[model samples]
Target: MSLSVTKKRSLAALAAACLASVALPATPALAQKVKNKTPAAEASASSVDYVVTIPSVEAVQSSMDEATITDILSGNLAGNAAALAELDATSITIPEITVTLDVEVDGETERGTLTLSNLVLEDVSDGVATSMRLNGSSFATPEGNADMGTISAENVNLAAILGIYGLVDAGASREMQTLYTDFLVGGGSFSSDEFSCDIGAISGGEVRGRPFETSFVEIISIAQSMEDNPEDISPELLGKFVRMYADLLTAFESSEFTFDGLDCAGTTDEGEALAISVAGITMAGMSPGIYPQLSFDGLSIVADDGTMALENFTLKQFDLSSVIATLEAAPELVEESWFEANGRGLIPAFEGFSFSGLSMDIEDQDNEGERIIADVAEFDLSLGQYLNGIPSALDTWARGLRVDLPEDSEDEQVQQLLALGITTIDAGFRIAAAWNADTNTIDVEEVSMSGVDLASVALKGTIANATEALFSLDMDEAMTAGMGMAVKALSVDVVDSGLSDIVLAVVSAEQKVDPKTLRPVFAGLAEGTVVGMMAGVADAAKLGSALSSFIAGKAKSLNISVEAKDDPGLSLEDFMMAEDDPTTLLGKVNIDASAK
Candidate 1:
């Protein structure tokens, strides 16, 4: 089984499940209702294999985004602003839209191709099974360092998979419908069954950071269900589900979501070695009742040297219970919220919903100035777990969320880089929330690195310059319980230092450098402008310049006392409560870096 095939099945089932969950009127009943008016009947339905070709996939995507997706049942805009925006943004420009499905629910398979030039409302509103096939796609930049070229898929199937439209009025139908199809690719010879294997490379676009050589095989399967299956389903529910599925498909087809370099060495028009690859894969899907799990295996991205860049690059496991939960709960939540907010209204008032628990790993190497920089980065993530709840209500009030973090609990690759002279190494930044509504907030706890080798660097003009200074900070919490609303509290402390060449040369061997660990110790001793100017970006020169001014102002009154006894340090309990509800604790924090 291939990851692509698995995704196909996973997505197909997902689409089916999503569609089935949204209740809709019987297809025949709705069709008859709109047939009374002759012009409406002709305009509202058609049985042509709908095919639309764009100059490029982007054009198709652009069109999807810009066009208003009317409610096929009601012919109204559906009052779904987000839906409108999403569809408007994903218009794709495909080379051709071919409908080649001939089914009779009997024992015979008939087939023919339907060419679609212009995609209008009538075709979709007719409830026809339209399959779309993508042949080629291209993306380029002027200088082209970041250019991706040539994406082609032959005889692609896109019937209900793409979605059908009905044209009546806004309040006519409260649901949408979809048909499902699965595409399979093989090399030896086309299979008699819809899904059978062939020996050949997958034919598609060339993505960077992926290996697509060795005659690897490719397959694409699709299946769909209507949005009118659940009992008492409404338009609001239908719209939300369709929008979610559409967004998922759009993401899978997007630059950010697609893996790069299937043939890792493919060249651009201007010619630069492609940096990634993931091809020669197979895909499939299966449903087992309550929840569906799609697994991928035998997936690899090989480099020019025959080395597998993604040796273990496979969907080893996937547990979508939370995702399933969200899908099931969203409609109910939307309906309840809408009615509560607007008095039994059917308008889709989309609150927010998200699925968390996702984990994956990738192993690869890239040519850094001189080294291959070989290693693996992995992560295990749970949305509602790691981030119990952020410090803001806005974070929780979102429509969707996704997160990608460093998979390796111990990011050895980064540590290896830091060990080398890569002082500015890119650390694995943890990704938690991917909220789609309003303000989105991400968190970065701290960076880890070894600091021993950097003890001798010197600043040309500052005070007795210091050398190696390795520091790490521990945060208590970014969010916590307050008097009422969610509250946020953060604490940062710095430690660790080694002498620079200048400082080492000036101090006597008998004088230990540890005592001078505090940079503020020297700054505190200063008298004038220095103390007042310490709240911004600081450099040795700036500190030096401000010292004299700081010494002049508070030198006499400066207090420098340290208590040897430990008494729980200092308490700012008075300031904690005010973090969220300012009326209670007062939004203030006491500064106490000193331990005595």
Candidate 2:
């Protein structure tokens, strides 16, 4: 049969069962009650009581006939003899149903009782029969309050039930067939007091499932055979077989294994009513080799008034080992080129973990207050490489880093700085590196950050032989080697123009420091430094004379460019470490500064 047609028939059967369970008893009684309440009738007793009984399968079929069952199916399975035949012998007997009402001048009270002794369905053609028996199931309200007794279902075969409705096909697996054979639940009850309502075993109420293939009979027989003939079954073979059976059972066992309790209520405390509740919950799932099994242990929730909390909420077997293994097994899952460019088949994994005690509170708010507060006492996560490819990954990420900023903005701060004679504000940085796997040489590319016109500074340089310098751990050696390495390009651009004077004026005005006093301090420091010495010579040779003049407002704009000679670098080792100013080594660089 087509899947859709099968599903429609299955749903029709389900709907019929639900309707029979609820509406069948009330329909006739409600019609009679309405007839008695008409104006033509005289006044009757203040209360009425009635009892109903649904007869056995054969008696009900004889009374209702084929048309009645077809009507109950709602035309969804019309003219389908096989489906109707399945329901013909299905017996649902309510041995006794009692409903009573008491009417008074001030108020009225209604109570009801429903007792279902057993519901049995047998399909001789399919060679399957299932039965459900409930004990002492009842509902009542005394003094406008509700109370209920324990209800338990026994001998439920879910697979057979589904098969009767044609929901299970012939090709169903052994695992699927075993799901419903011998499923049982017991010790289920609910009660409520003036202050609180409690549900006992609401979490499936001690559910147990014994599949047909793994029946107790088979298990006992295997045990007895092993005991009777010890030499026939080797210890290793026995252990292996036991393990296999355990694994198979776990794969088929998907129901919640256990649940403790649940309670909810609204109670008055300090003349104020507040809602509160607490529940202990746990659940498990089966995933064969990928996970083998997974579960949440000691999971619970509590809430009262303005606060809610989760306690001992732990998840087991949430690690990525299985995921990595799956990916490795199916390399085609991710594009090969993408993995090669990025991680080169490397993946990250973490050890298994658990987190607990998460909470949130809605505090009482005043005129201006935050609505909620949340906290976590501790959070710990650690990352580890599944393969030895950390260095390559780091290098790839470093070389890809780039920071781009706008050259101009209309923000109030930018306008204010512009009013102080600052023009372009393009400011950002980028990092580049080169790694040669063949030679094992690590040459870090140029790292540069530039401010176009605000401070007019540009720095560009490369770090060569970085691996050796970094490993030495000697700052002086690293520095000497760095300075001696090749310089691709180096330049500094500054337009002191009135920016420095404007800044001095603002700082002096704000801090009451005299500009005359600060300027001398800056000029003295400039002349005493090696950089200052270079600047003095450049200015004397008129290399940067135009730029200096423009900063003094002699020209409208200025641009300066400096170049290092063929062997130019630095004499810092002799100057700083040896305390000797090596002028000749410094003269290797040349500067050419000018204005437009």
Candidate 3:
């Protein structure tokens, strides 16, 4: 499933607040007999006194065979729960368990095997396994291979899972539910001709997937009993499902998951090699619809084309409650890209997202050996104050930036920098905006981009009558209504330090003239264009003089603004109406300019 940016954070926030994914601690395994003193050596290495390990548990054994458990798990939860609880074995240990299957590789069927050893389920009583452990595993195929260490879970309750299965099959009793109080994985890795990945230990606690009997069982049963079509599910039933699911999420007193680390490498179809590593990932304090927190630490990716890294990342207050409501209303939308439907704001409304210590090295695919590198100390975005299901206030910031230009480049941008003898840029960027619901306007308070020893440009503007229709998800509706919105006012300021001198030198060289001689000539042309463009709209000469002064090096800054002569503002409709004779309306718009 493709996720919105906010949901992607949720997925990465521990690979889907995978607190819901806290498995039975089953690690990726290879299909070979593990050689060692004991595969359970790590689990047994703990304080527990383990029983003797059997040479192997034959799958042929009818009732007691380990493979039988897999069948019972899927056949009927109602009987399986009781059958498992009745197992006479106080503790069972198996030396090896091998599984075989055929999987497609490169569009061809290839046989694969996964052999696991040191399997132990200890203290099975009252349908609860005090602990379960699988120590070693190796899986192999012609196309790939994988190996893993001990994967263990403690306090596995057969009852915790049966309840959910019971709802689906109508055979499992509430007592047949499943839950594993705690889980842990030593570590593992897998590889194929195309790619490879290494995973660090994963762990979590209070992983209870079964829902409360009163909270969700009835709704689940009703849904399960219905035909598989969303149309067949009543609005009330869909609403119930969403509510019950959310209730199930809220019922969890505690649930958390963490991925200690990850390192992966692969070759793209283009044959470009890529490597990625992440130090740690974690998600905690999760609730249905809204997740309290998810974070990533020390992530880096390198490829033939580019390299990117970040010291840390965090997402807070991830919310998908709005989408849930959509699902409840039009269940069919869920079958489509429902999250993107009209009025569904941002899929999941994330309160904020931020990253620190970021660096990027970008290489031009078309230009061999040419690249741009930069390091950014921090970047942040925050959203809040809802209007028309949209966040009225949106703020963005990026600071402590340093950029390096590739040397000896053929790119025009590079040549311009070289003309100014600029190989690097120290810069920062920021934007702030908010919606004025009372005024029906969107105020762009500021938008700024600046570089040290370079130059700075800033803008402030507003969009009037930015109503709900303007923010509608329907493109045609929004576009039609948008054309009616007024372009209220706009202001721009360009300030130069040494950048003016560099510009003059570059222009002089391009014109084959002296820098001192080009300044006035260039400034004159700029003034003339400004004066002619609007037919003396709002003191054009004064604005032209300001531009001329700055371009001629008589000033270091130029400020300009535009406003419609009519009181409220000028809309896109007005522009379109004037398209046939735009020059006729030029004098109606006022322009103001100045310099210092």
* TM per prediction: 0.28, 0.27, 0.66
Scored by TM-score, the top model is 3
lDDT per residue (tens digit) for residues 1-596 in model 1: 00101111122222221231111111101110111113343332212111122222223323333233222112222233224322322233323322232322233433333333222221121222123333322221122211112222222212222222211122322232222222212222122211222234333331111111110111111111221234455555454553354223212210112222132234434543233333444322322111112222234433333333333333322333333333434442355444343321222222223222222223333422222332333332333321111211122211111222223324576554433323332222222333222222223232222133222111111011111110101122222211112112223322223323233323423365543343345555542343343333223234444443233222211112222122222134533644765443211222222211
Q: Candidate 3: lDDT over CA atoms? A: 0.66
Error of 2 at 480 (Å): 33
The candidate, 2 or 3, that scores higher on TM-score is: 3
| Cα lDDT computed for each candidate against the true fold | 0.27, 0.39, 0.66
Tens-digit lDDT track for model 3 on 1-596? 11111111111122211221222334342111111112354321111111111234433223355544543321222334546544544676656655554433334555666577777777776556789888978878787898877888888765444344332232433332337767788888989999999989988886645445442335435444342344565555554565455445443434788989889999988999999999999888565566677789999999877889999998867666765454445552233243345445435677888999998888766777776678989899999875446677999988888877777777798777876889888888889999887888889988999888878899999878787787676779888877778877889999887887887778778879889998898899999997888654668899989999999889988899987778468877677878887776566677889999
Best candidate according to lDDT: 3
Candidate 1 residue spans exceeding 4 A from truth = 1-424, 428-596
Backbone Cα, N, C clashes tallied per candidate:
90, 0, 17
Give the better candidate number (1 or 3) by TM-score.
3
Compared with the true structure, what per-residue lDDT tens digits does model 2 show for residues 1-596? 00111111122223333333321211111211211221336433333333333332332433235344433322232233234334433454434333333222224545454444333333322322344443334444452233333333333443343432333332344444332223233323444443555544422322222233333223434454454445566544454344435434333334444444445555454544554444554555433322322233333333343565555444443233433443334332234343344342233333233344555556436523433444443332222222322222111111111122122444577567765555433343433445444443434443444343333443434322333443223557657755555442354444443456777677677779887566655544533453455654544345435544554444544454444455333334433643565454445556555555
By summed lDDT, which 10 consecutive residues of candidate 1 come out lowest? 25-34
Q: Native-vs-model 2 lDDT?
A: 0.39
Task: Tell me which of candidates 2 and 3 scores higher on lDDT.
Answer: 3
